[model samples]
Target: MTERLLAFLILCLVAGAPFGAALMWTGNLILDFVFFYPLFMSGLWTFGGLYYWLHWERFWPWSPDAPPPTLKGTPWISILIPCHNEAEHGADTVLSALNQRYPHVEVIAIDDGSTDDTGAMLDRLADTHARLRVIHLARNQGKAMALRMGALAARSEYLVCIDGDAILHRDAAVYLAAPLVDHPRVGAVTGNPRVRTRSTLIGRVQVGEFSSIVGLIKRTQRVYGQVFTVSGVVAAFRRGALDRVGYWSLDMVTEDIDISWKLQRDHWSIFFEPRALCWILMPETLRGLWKQRLRWAQGGAEVFLKNLPGIRAWRHRRLWPMALEYCVSTIWAFALALSMALWTTGLFVALPGHIQVETLMPPAFTGMALAAACLLQFCISVFIDHRYEHGLFRALYWVIWYPLAYWLIGLLTTLYGFPRVMLRRHRARARWNSPDRGIKAPTS
Candidate 1:
């Protein structure tokens, strides 16, 4: 661990020094890109969201009242909830799955070596709900392994896996499976994820984060005929598709990303199912939030390297844009870092009023323009999910926290994760730690 830490530090310094010096040279150009990039991303998302929402039937053909069309036998789906130390909310998760309105469904709840009472909760629930199956591991392997165990035991052709803490929408399984059953080539479907814990300002910010950024990007990725990955929170996959892609990777820090890349590279189609919603709790503290984002970013970098060689093949042409998008995002992250450093240095060593902070920010209207973009994106997102108006519309007074918190968090995680991922080419360890489950109904 010590050696790896040293190597990561060396990599960061070696990379940061040259970029820092260059930013001091071309200061103005970098600032323009920083301001303009948000607008560009917002535009892409706006177009993508409108296109996907307007053309909803392109993915989900079955109406809300209609059941999914199945052939021959009963169309069954196994809902896998992989948990570790989630006993606090394990029952809630299982109850949500058990409450799924889909007629033919089972909940496979795995208690992954939790030191808490997670296993007992599952057992008691299993005894009550005939559709619930419990698997208790003696020791905590990682989430990927736990999911694999549940998948292997599932009897259905269609499988949906969500985090142990996620509360599934009453009809999530039906919506998630519509595309898969309707379109034979569709391998996996990701649902629209909403924030559950709004007890603190941090949780409220994540509500907008999901709707404004995460939600928009998934829609846009769908418009392009490929999404980087399925949402781990509530994604459904066909067993045949899982077999083709060799199932989820046990060694990946982010199995969700690894599986996404594998499926896309193999020519399997992935879709976003907005009607299939899952409400999840998020970290309400900065420490927890930073760790969560860092882990996610690290997973992206790892998946990028793992699939870098495929770019040379002619069949992998569709995947090139995804790779380019991540790379550009990394560049944007570094550019933001550079802009900040230059601004900081100017604060100390400016030539008597010559250098100003605006020198690093856009010349005019960028702030107002960016704020407008955020509001516009939020409004569009909430329109698709009107039930959550209080999370976005009513919270607009506090929405300003989203950009300030997200920008800093995004930049730092990209910087930190990129270096660690780069240095980890030789040796990378996969360890999973559960985040704060946040307020879980105040425990009676």
Candidate 2:
């Protein structure tokens, strides 16, 4: 029975890949027709253009007209900052948390065995700030482990995890916690992360991508109460929920994703609050950006494989939508790679007739229209994001190159991730390599 079950599972995977590929091809073809037809492409482009248009208003920061909520008697919040060789920015992150307008907050900066001056900095920060505390690890551990330790040590009812490189806005904590006041079922709330450095072209492109893809999609998902992953840069969780989920899983590279999945399994609703913003420094160079995205892609694959069974077994009707979105998305990566191969090969094949270039013009025109529409979509997102960040000149320049860069990056990372997941070759423990920090030997 065991052998039979294993064979059946392999067969199912084999069958699913081709079926998924066909579905993706069909979906793309339909999209092409709807967004590229000469008569309809413009209209569809205008309508599809609304995603970015809506994103602007949807993700704009909280209005001053709307008064801040009166804290429900000041719920004690334990702010967790997982630091790994972030000595340069450690003090800044801690200071940001300590400077929060919200009273009754405990800030815990976990030094995850940094070889640098991070521990000493944390200690110095703790000396001045009464609310600040520090945890020291003897050996280097990944962010997941650091977060788990911080969560376990939290004395408050609520926990807020912020990356060491992230700077929280004054109202960030208050905005993140306000949701819990009304929604008892909410287990976690993700704050918006804005790009702090748009000085480089790569940073500018990422800023646009974040606004259009991550920011917009997350808001839509939030509307449905089905946010997939909480931003690791800044997110708040109920201590009870973290305890119930056994804290962050150290096995996955993307601990944020793993915890979100676990929370969903435990029937906890995750929310995306655009009102709360955390400023983060984006990768300034292409090499740095590539490494950052590659880690995310690999981590996504790791999480999907680790939680596939539980996700499939979920009983809620909403779980199907979530699962389908995730599974189909991963499978579509392979399909896209395959389609690119076909398109490349097709260019070399020739027919033995008078080649009417006009015959191919329709598809070419369709492709161009689709591309233009996609660019317009990005422009809309940038406009919305710029309302808060104000990098209009840089954003407009980056928009032209973003689509191609995004596609190529996705393709390369997904290709690299697919085989690693399939062969079960990834380390169960999350790797602590900081891709944003240039790959260099750390000096003590």
Please give the RMSD to the true structure for each candidate, in Å.
Answer: 4.1, 5.5
TM-score of 1: 0.88
lDDT of 2 by residue, 1-444 (tens): 543454356435733674444454453453333223323422333343355346554554455235555677678878999998898766777888888878878899999888889889889888888888899999888999998889888898678889987888777887888776667888999998877665667766776777766776676666555767899889999888888889888888788888888898889999877767787877877778877888788777666666665666537556566666655555445555544544454577752222211122236666676567666666666655565565554666676677668767876887786555556633667747754733221111
CA deviation > 4 Å runs, candidate 1: 1-25, 57-73, 346-358, 387-391, 425-429, 440-444
Top TM-score prediction, candidate number = 1
Model 2 quality (TM-score): 0.83
Candidate 2 ranges beyond 4 A from true positions:
1-67, 343-362, 437-444
**TM-score of each predicted structure versus truth:** 0.88, 0.83
